[model samples]
Target: MESNSSNPYKDCLVNEERRLIDERTNVGTVEKKKIAIHMAQSNSDNHTKELDLGTKTPKPIQPILSAYPCTGLGKDRRCFQPQWYKSFTWIEYSITRNAIFCFPCRNFPTQPQKGYLFVIGYQKFRKVKEFLTAHGETNGHATNVILWNHFKQSLIEGTIKEKFVALTKSEIMPPGNAHYCSPPLQNQMLSAAGNIILKYIASEIREAGYFDVMADDTRDVSSYEQFCICVRYVDKTNTPKEFFISFEKVVDLNAESLTKTLISTLNNNSINAICVAQAYDGASVMKGHLSGVQEKYRKNHKMAIYAHCYAHKLNLVLISACKYLPQSRKTNIGENRASWRNFCQNHHSSENNDHIRSYKIPIDTLNIYL
Candidate 1:
């Protein structure tokens, strides 16, 4: 539909098409369509973008406002004080709804309770302080608050206050009133927070009834062998999760010493009995069938089957495959179309290749993967 077309046939078709469309829907404007779509979507329980509490990624609007409208109500004239918004930063004021909503709970509700703060927003201006304070103190509220903080941490890799400053120096929170600015206090706070988070992860693992153990040893910058132990389990939602529980200096690298440390760590957490699997790199000290770390762990929990670390095997494979590469491919393949040439060579060389030729079955792939 080019404007002012010279061809009469084209002009006639365009005008006729426009007429039919206009007749079908008298108001075919984009604005009208948008309004209709919004009206249709408004009845559902789904939250619209406006009420998503700035949780959607790829940047979000600043939620904390400097001034919350004081909706004066009740006999003693109780209302939402604008100053309160400063103290309780998790609360968000809705202009359209004329209510305050819990920003954290709205996004990450810990329970299936139907609190107004989580969805429709809270408008009980009368006794607002009493209810708001009580809501803040709830375990669910605290959990969601922590979760919201964790979400913010994911969006920006920095301290909470630093995140605030980076986001816009938080409206309710002034820069001067910020506390725990000192390094020592920050370290202490971080340690306590880590312990709390670790406790929650450990509790979730134990609650899941069964879990797998993962341990690896690596040399730190100072050349000290650091033995790290972690656990992998499916959560209540059936989503797999791995949480690091311990990272300690390895005074001894012997299988017995490593077994003792690992066993003690699991016993302390009371998950040693329920351990269903243990994965470690193919090191003689760790995976040796005869009295190795795996054998020692299996002695206590026979159900805990041993597995060679997949990632470790992949690393070994990659290193071994590097030896098969041509010197031309191994050279500066990054520069001047070398990578492209190598990729083309590999692609053409693999043209007739089939999965049957590479691996007869899926179990074969798994066996090689292990």
Candidate 2:
């Protein structure tokens, strides 16, 4: 049984429902919000995105009244109604508890609710109409609504907020140059949409149970070393699928550093993937039997296999090629080899030998004549 003791919330309420839903669930708040909102259709990175379809929390999502359970004394039985949800926009239903609640009051009820009412839940559908209207008129509900509107305004208007009621009433976009169209708002929208997609993908991968990891590091034009992590798994149909999940900035190419960075990124995304295999080029830091990334990772997932793939190194070569292009040549990533001949020194020899030796060499980079 849940504790009858009520904990009053006194925080802002714009996007607060996400926190409430998560708190009601067992998972982390950020992760739960991502997966829940993931159901909303949003722009994909590969697509040529247009502004009109930008990410936005259009409205609050409540439960379907059709599924509401019924209860009451003889002949006066009642169930939640769709019209009530429509009339009281603040209405929310918890399928777990088999009851309806007020979205605002559930998190930040300012006044005491006798019999727990909407704060905990209000089940007497027979009296719901009378009680809901009266509750809405109370000072508690009005105060909570004020705070919610303020936070909502901050998100869309770059201020804490005070405008949900007004914004919902507006039909058209408030001109492109308006404060609502600011870059910070656009970036936040894009990030929110991206996190939603990432969390959804993470869920699918974890549900698949066993997976393989693929990773490689590269020096970006900004001189930052980034490790790109990918995962491959077979879905319920036994069909193989692969996804690029993250590109994390790392301190260096040390096996320990890479392992920590990779593990942290995976955990943050809530992807506790059971790695069955790991694929990477045969660099000592990646494939070394003593203490490489594969070995370190296997300490956590002992069953994982280390599979070397020559083609996996192609990703880094592509990054190297980008530096040679006319658009990028002007701003070069520093190199100290002096000349192409000196850069290729000691012999343009055997492929595997060069591969291992190149793995631990200086940071000046290779003889990329491309």
Look at candidate 2 and give me any clashing residue pairs.
149-162, 150-160, 150-161, 150-162, 154-159
TM-score of 2: 0.39
lDDT scores in order: 0.67, 0.63
- Per-residue lDDT of 315-358 in model 1, one digit per residue for the tens? 65444434444443455534646644453335324432342244
Candidate 2: which stretches are off by over 4 Å?
1-181, 313-370
lDDT of 2 at 106: 53
Tens digit of lDDT per residue, candidate 2, span 91-110? 77555444566666655556
> Which ranges of candidate 1 are over 4 A from the true structure?
1-179, 270-273, 326-370
RMSD of each: 22.2, 26.5
Task: Indicate which candidate wins on TM-score.
Answer: 1
Q: Record all residue pairs in model 1 with backbone atoms less than 3 Å apart, i.e. clashing.
A: none
